[model samples]
Target: MQARKTIIRLFTTFLQFDSDKAIGWVTDGRLRRNIVNSQVYSSEIENSENFWVTYWYKQWQDNPKSLAKEHLLAYLQETCYWVASKTVKNIYSPQYTVSDCFQMMIARTDKVLKGFKPEMGFGLKNYGSAIFSSELKELLRQEQEIDICTNWRLLRKLTQKRLTESLENIGMNSKIIERYILAWKCYQMLYTPTQRTGTRKLQKPTLQTWEAIAELYNNQRLKQLPTNTPECSPEIIEKWMVASAKAVRAYFYPSHISLNVPHGNSEASRELIDDLPGDEEKSPISQIVIQEEKLAREVQQDRIKSVLLTALEELDEESRKIIQLYYGAELSQQQIAKKLEMKQYNISRRLSKSREVLLYKLAAYCKESLHISLNPPVLDYISTLMKEWLKLKFNPPTSEMEN
Candidate 1:
């Protein structure tokens, strides 16, 4: 009973420490090997009920400072990967590969682990798997929804493009083009063919649909004007729909007006006039400004590369390898884990830590050597730029690159 009390107390103490600092304590090479090499801990971990809870409690009791994050990370990696793989199969998109799923799982698991309660009498595997699966499903659902919306928008754009061309050919006014498009879309939504009957039905537009279309049009118009514009009324929208229907009917019927040299005298004519080629030569001042801006960007990129290279050199060999394998070699974390004989989650942690260290060192180098102090946002941008540069430099080119 005393041992049980001691174990509970130890578990509470482990929970008190910040996860990163606690993990860092066990991430030390010697400490990790010590924990892994322990015959008693190994035997208990494999055979015991509530393995992680019992193992962690034992570590805390034996040495309060000897918390092993590697064990926790290994369990997280295995469970997360399994859950991610299963989840990805359910997702229809080929783009959401096992690697992508695993990456997302690991990213979310970090935050989830911080909230883990070992004292709740559940093992980490069940708790962690539940969290992993929930997050993966949510992510996949969001991506699928986004894809559906994007495809719908693209189809709408194509329809609008063809409609716009037809309207312009008939010399329709530009100002009312969008209003006509919105009214037409509302009409289609209200009157599309019924799936079961496979027949087009004429349906009256609902007041709600008309109001929504007006609001959308008004919002779009408001963005273009410097001053506030009055919102369109439903009455005015109905009149516009009447006018659009008349114009569309006239468009289908052959008439002298339709053949009147395409009426090259309306707003559409002005648009065509604007699109006509002007002088090819740029003004000298504009040319010089463009050249100077390009040069400045090039110089900034070079400076960022130089600073990042210096920082990379300053990192320890292991951290450097993590960066190289990830950014430089483009290998996934699981692949790096196999190469290094470490847990996949450990590889993720190391890569993240290495990037943080590199950013810090880069900031320090800029302050001392370049006489410039970078804020967090700027440092983040520089780090992203450096990673992109490494990818471009190391990754094999696609067909576009070969061309």
Candidate 2:
């Protein structure tokens, strides 16, 4: 448990993956390859351009069947303890603690990475053991600062150096060591947030692409509504037809418009809502695939409109129409009331109530779209910012992280 805690802390800082969103990104293989190597016991070995001149180089033409790359890697993992023992022998320190074991890997350690190249059975000279001095470390540090944080493996040695020093200060007190390790785990958990799946700043191509997607989705939605189930009554059909119309209407006036386009709402916004599949006719068990396909389509389309429309679908058609006319069509409350043959005050009351429903929907939408858990205020801020982000490209003024 103590080890786990410290490791968690190490992961938090190393990968910045505290949230589920962060976890999803990491697990999905969307993270930097360096993290796997430097952060965890990564299996991959990256050979640089002058890889032969630096470390991890190998001389071709030797006993080729000696050690396979896969075998060598497996051996490294399986024999780290033995390696630690060998280091201890070289260093001649008993009670040296785990820090010394890692230090062995860091410096004053030498080993022949035995590996054989297949096909020709050539003898390979593996240079697995080498130490970096402070000067070398400085060079490494400079390289990291110049590079993006994606190459986190380069940062691990540095992180470990400090952590090892910190660990050494605590002496060998078991309780103290346990406490510190626990703290480390908590630290890792805290640092991890949402990971960047794609580029952060919204660009013109992305917006235009989304706009095109919205149109395609609108057609698919129209096709899907009637195909979902057996025929139903006029009342049910009316409910769906009016709700769909309202959603279409509401889509016109987005709460926040994408900034990439000089004209925010000049281009048409597509409606992408489908009437709920006939739940009454549904089997006792649900078809997850069908639902997933629908959800995936929703995600692919103008995700923003999909989110708002989803909320609009939950309310009665009358309320939905009123809300749509009020916000979507930019209709005055009095005008909406007059068109619907209702009192102006009633229109106001319904719009307010529908707004609450839509707000909840927007919150859920943000969670799905950004993979960020946000409360009302945070959701509002994110929604607003995303709209602003949409208007600009990932260039000097808008881009925060320099690629």
Candidate 3:
């Protein structure tokens, strides 16, 4: 079963649990009476009834009970309520998908029909209900958030401070070429995602901020920002250094990049559509074909990520630090080398060797798990194969598999 389908089935079962099965305590039932010594009292008694436990044990157990009755008393009432509440929530929550609805409906039909499908009607005819034909229309709607932004002035103040701090940190030592990337990191939070950028709530930044950042970068390129030996406020610089690092930190957080492959989607998608670097006048179908090919390429990249994480686990602290400081931390080769107190050349050599070893490990795992030979290890082909494997799992075969 597909994971989603299995989850739906389990959730549906929770929704439709019998009251008897869900209630964990005998006292939770409709009947409640005190069976006292020599007097079968039909009186409703609270759990505080005297020596009720000993009386129940004597009457109910065939022998000495396995569990101490005292041990269960504290939890029995609470457990029954919890179980019943959980069942109710699981069945009716909107979080339950159509697959859950299908399971519940089928189960209800089975019980009432007694070994006959609701569709078959169990040797009954003319039981058909009236059918209505209408145009497809959407009914569900709710109030939406208005497209007004908040805290505009406060946001601008933060952005100004952030830009200044970033400049102070990267002064003299920073590569001028990476100024665009620096500007992007500082204001990344400001820009809405592509899907939401069209929405009116997220205000676009004025050209002034971009122009200011560009002008500063140009001055730095012309040897005009701060000098290595300039008189400075060491305290202010330190604070800015921390702030700048934090801004960079946001870009490299694990949650940003570790998106799961969608249920009908996968992380194997590529940025191939960014440029569309081929014949521009091609048919739409050809472009789609190109996208499909791009989707296939990410499977291997995903595999590479898995292999790298495993390799990092097996390495010493120093090596693991280098791997993350290079990859997950998104530090450039020179930056990582400076952080680690190693030569840039050495960093390059280590990264190259790690890549070779890690790819070999992934190839071995592929062969072991799926019997895939992966001749010459074409990454794009591997990605395609992974997609096909996923499709095969959910798309049941029309014909029997050959033994």
**Winning candidate number (lDDT):** 1
Q: Report the C-alpha displacement of residue 4, candidate 2, in angstroms.
A: 56
| Candidate 1, residue 122: lDDT | 32
Span of ten consecutive residues with least summed lDDT in model 3:
128-137
lDDT per residue for candidate 3 within 1-403, as digits (tens), equals 1111221121111211232222111221101111222123312221322223223232223222222222122212222223223333433345333322222222222122122111111110001000000000000010011112222222232344444444444453354314433444434444333434334344434555444544444444346433542322323333433445444333221111111112335564432112212221111123333334334434544554565467546766766566666645547889999998999998898876655555566566666754566675343333333322222333322231111
Ordered list by lDDT, greatest first: 1, 2, 3
Global lDDT scores for all candidate models: 0.50, 0.34, 0.33
Candidate 2: regions farther than 4 A off: 1-301, 382-403
RMSD to native for every prediction? 27.8, 33.7, 28.6
Top candidate, metric TM-score: 1
Task: Name the TM-score of candidate 1.
Answer: 0.32
TM-score of 2: 0.21
> For candidate 1, lDDT tens digit of each residue in 1-403?
0111222222211111121111111122332334444433344223332443444433433443333433344345445545655565644466666656656666565545554534322346555766676677776765454344322232232356656665776788776586567656654554332333422222345677667767666666656533454577767776766565444334322221110112366664422112222222111123333334444544644665676777778888998888788866667899899999999999988888877876676667556655665767556544544454555445522321000
Error of 1 at 60 (Å): 62
